[model samples]
Target: MAEREYTAVVYSTTSGRVIYDLDLADDPEWSARINDVGGGRITVPLQGGAGTTRVREWCVPLRYSLGVLLGDHVCQAGPIVPYAPATDKRLLTVGFKGFWELLNRRVLHNKAWNPASAKITDPSADIAITDSLPNIARAIVDHGTTWQNRPGSFLPLDLPAVLPGTGTNVRNYPGYETASVGQRLQEITQVDSGPDVLFQPYLTTSGGFRYIRHRMLIGNPLLVQLGGALKFDYRSSLVALSIAGDGSNQANTAFVKGSGNEAGTLFGYATDTTLIDAGWPALDMVDASHTSASVQSTLDGWARADVALYGTQPEQWQAVVRADAAPPVGSYSPGHYADYSVKNHHWLPNGLYNYRILGVSRSSGTPRGCVDHQLQAVRTG
Candidate 1:
């Protein structure tokens, strides 16, 4: 059997990277030409050496070496698709509309990844009561809890009906359908209303302080089946229906009160309402001036209820506070800071001593303040 012969060639690129030839053959003439023994720009036949019988050829190394080196730094290969600002405008508008459509459909209520029966568990039954369009509308007006069993009767029917620029009509409404994920994504990339609508909620001065509460549920058997310890950055922000300190609206005052400067505080002191001051050291330090034992007790009760509702090991649960803005007085930067933790199920006194104050901003008029809460199980691994 005859062995294959190949020639190797080496060269340098403008970038100073050394490259080697890929196509090589063990041909003496080819090897000599490629080696450039005399270091000449052009290979010349040896003196009187039978005028170059064969030509040596080699592959360039620069292409492959530089290609591999450049690959790592690049995010996407090939020509980039240009994005126009107008396209972005279209996407935002459609994406917003699509998002609301999906929200109205209650698509977030059940996961397509799970079986219908499994996805629609007892919670589904409970949610269904208020899930109906009518009940949801009622919930908006009455500010009352929806009973399980009713369909198409939820709160804020106006929410799903009102279109852009149209006057608020709580009664007469327009029906819009929810879009699928593909449709939503398409709307986000294209400028057409092919799938969704883009709109922003308008918050009027009449609206009061909105509180957003995110409950992280962990250790649920059903949740475990989907995946152990689900982490959801759930958000729910509500506003007090009436002005604080007003006797006529005492029931609503439990959340907030007063129309103007004399607004009475409910659910605790003013500092308690500020997310940054809600956690440990900050809370405890301020307790002397603003917080009462009753306030601390209320926080503890809320924490316990959260654990009971979500934690698998109710006793092992921990709470981490995230504030939305700078601490009124602290050396901490105006950013998220770990301000609290529960050890062995013991609820820390002062409710503020153990947690670190994480500064965050909640200036956005939206009722839901920004905060992320992750529920995790103690890992044995």
Candidate 2:
């Protein structure tokens, strides 16, 4: 069976309590509706740390957890808007980001006196493992009790050995951009940690925070054969395909230049390539606020990864497929959804099809709740 009802649960993240629960309605096109859902991405918005908006004449503050419920599962979207008023003339255009989106809104952990560390030291020498993304990710996420679901790292960071007590004082600021925690984390996984550690921050269907490291964009595939896939009477289906290439997913030559506060050589370069291309070149510079030799090595590793992704040959891509199915309305199912534990229809790498509900939105219309939410997936292999 499919679900036809929805409830937007509002609760204080500050206090962690249910304040109100608003259900899906088909009254008019001016209230609320849910649609455009993805596995880890959705569109739901809030404001300030607190405030109020008019819902059916009643004022609802912009604080607390704004969770969406459909069928049998509930997922936390984010905090409510803090300061929007009920009488604002313009339509309050608020599109909250997935948990990962919100998480990526802050800078990574780095300070003037001390920056995040990517250096590898003997297990006995350095206990903090400071700059490690896995280590840093935990510290960054373990802050609030409001929406911090499960905090852990799944990165198989089988980092190789490094000399102990080499640059005991050398450090990297990793730069500070009022950017997102996700963005800051990007700086490391893409440039600092190099190929040794690459990760993608994601939110589980259960609302837990996790890092998809080794999987890259390729998770276990989902089979959609006649009797192999979950049974769903889908109403509509869409498959979008595209291909691209840098003509260089792999290179025999790679280089990285860096900059920072420490005073060393004015010019330096790093190469981790082993191929004999006569001169297959892949180059990049890192202003990620690094100047140490360790940083140079890290940058070199990044160059190698880039070559791997854009050097060797044309990158073969896949198409994205989306569907819409809801709880059985009678004899037809419009979309398909299930628990994270079950084989839900969400996105996957290598064509494992599944779906996750990001959140929903509300808009004014002839019938307030008349929006079609779609379930999107990738073309299964």
Candidate 3:
């Protein structure tokens, strides 16, 4: 097989303009996550020629972004950040975090301006939004991107389109809260009746380089079966497998405390009686924060979701597969379903198990040419 070459380019964050092209990146590796910010790394020699110096100068942390490409397709992209130089004093490495970091940097409320004082200040009341889960998420992002003293080139991102009519989720951000946009999104989407939030990147057909699209998807985005031709079969594509089971942090009961003081405080509990009836002691967990939860059902929603996730012995499966294997890299992303099977075990029998893909990681220039897939069992009990 021929050597794989990866190229990179830097773009201005505020104006989305091309800043520089990184033609000499070494050891480029990237990772993507479903629920959190993903990142990548590229290395350059410190003593290289004029171009190397240019890469160092143009890579302004937080102001610029790096987009890695395989031919014309962008494999990974993110805002550039500083990293400690490589130990040998020969190479310099810079890190780039995913576009999701933009959400992390902003808050729930748009900046407010006072006419008489001629100044901008935080809103007087908390941001309260009640809508379908997807719509509510989009609202948070829309207002979160707006600020009072933005640069001239700072353009507010357009609200993303979301699937219609999926029940409702209530979120409240008190005036004092200033909660992170990313954290707020995660909190709303990870609960019962919530959809999965995905920040996907795409290249523009015209002149726009790489752009990110915020999406809310319900359930698994793609489903793979045990006998499907495109799968991570243990007999073929699976290079190595590591299975881990842990119940140390497991809980069968959850007491969710909502906003209020003293006797007026809202409290809700959800318990998985099946676990207790099966001889496992009733382990309890308390989540004391929904400061904006006005109704008891809001706290109950969180309680049920928490109990479902933490109520069982969670198992994590990490599998490494050849990059060119069926359902290759880029073909499958986080939130897809994978049907895995292991043949003949002494204690664990030969059977098929379903898991939801949580993350994907790959490193170019490695001898293995492998993609690491992280998965967790889809709890449906």
Candidate 4:
């Protein structure tokens, strides 16, 4: 049997926080070398090793003004910008212009040497944009066909307005609240002029508001498929209740958890029940007398309805149940069920909050059932 030669490549991120490792098989045609390999470390030549490969190299020049800080002994470190070799299969994080430059240089310029490849199952862009109601309708008509044909794919859209009185409004249409704007734009743009457009809203939820945004991705279940619940006592603001309903309180002063970007806060846990017996807090931060079962049921119902109408399966959706003794407003913070205006403040003062649901066919990848866009007129405080 021919000996199989392998090379390990380990490189750290620019921030020095993440380290990536790659194992490559030696191919004589590539003429690569594994200079050293031991103790979980390997080094390879800049060229030659494995099969034919594409590599991106970057270099940064550094400058410095002499400075030192110390009381007993002085030590110095220079400012250095690091470089890491880019892998072929991984997505490259770069600026828009940089991406365009790379695409033009590697893909477009070297078409003869490297054939421009396309995705076999090219999912539509995660989000879409549009401006007019008729255009949104037309987008639904068109993209809807494609989405229905592909079950796992998603399409979203952004538009200036979809309110009831908007010139190109489609809120009156049923199921519009659930249909994504991308489908709407694809349906309407082909037929008429629409307004300015952008990407669709990606939805996420957490405790407290019952709809706090998280870093998780929406539309695709693979991103955040894990389901669990957690509980915390705002009164102490110190300890975390474990998923096993065990009180594993940490002495760390910074311990708050949820979906938002706040630091030292933990959010959802892995268990369906919490160790703390307190009731779920109200939206206004006032203590609610509701039973945990009741609150859990309400949240479960919302998730179930969402899945029944939009999700492909019940397991694809998950929710976090929080028990707070105080209402959000009572805590002088944003309240749950606050009007859409307080929720999506990025839009103009009068912009409405719209809801849409959509279903795409698993076989043909075309869109099937589409809820017309629902526009809740933006409320002025």
The digit string of per-residue lDDT tens for model 2 on 300-377 reads 655655544334444333222232333222111222232222122343233233443222222332122223323433
Residue-level lDDT of model 3, residues 1-381, one tens digit each, is 234466677776665555666645364788777766888888765666875577667768987887766555565666787766777666678889877787787655544422244422345435767777767777666666654544331431345566466645566676456678787887776566666666655445326554432233333223222334346667567676767788877999998887789898888788888878888887999887665567777778889988988887687777777767677666666777776666754434567667777877766633355767788763333
Q: Relative to the unseen true structure, what is the C-alpha lDDT of residue 259 in candidate 3, on a scale of 0 to 100?
A: 76
For each of the candidates, give the backbone clash count: 48, 47, 0, 72
Top TM-score hit: 3
CA RMSD per model (angstroms)? 27.4, 12.4, 4.2, 25.3
TM-score of every prediction relative to native: 0.16, 0.42, 0.82, 0.17
Which residue runs does candidate 4 get wrong by more than 4 Å?
1-149, 155-193, 200-204, 207-381
Per-residue alpha-carbon lDDT of candidate 4 for residues 38-84, written as tens digits (9 for 90 to 100):
01111222444332242232212121101111111111111122334
Better of 1 and 3 by TM-score: 3
**Model 3 lDDT at residue 50:** 74
lDDT against the true structure, per candidate, is 0.21, 0.32, 0.66, 0.21
Question: Cα deviation of 8 in candidate 1 (Å)?
Answer: 50
Candidate 2: 10-residue stretch with minimal lDDT: 212-221
How far out, in Å, is residue 349 in model 3? 3.1
* Deviation from native of the Cα of residue 115 in model 2, angstroms: 17
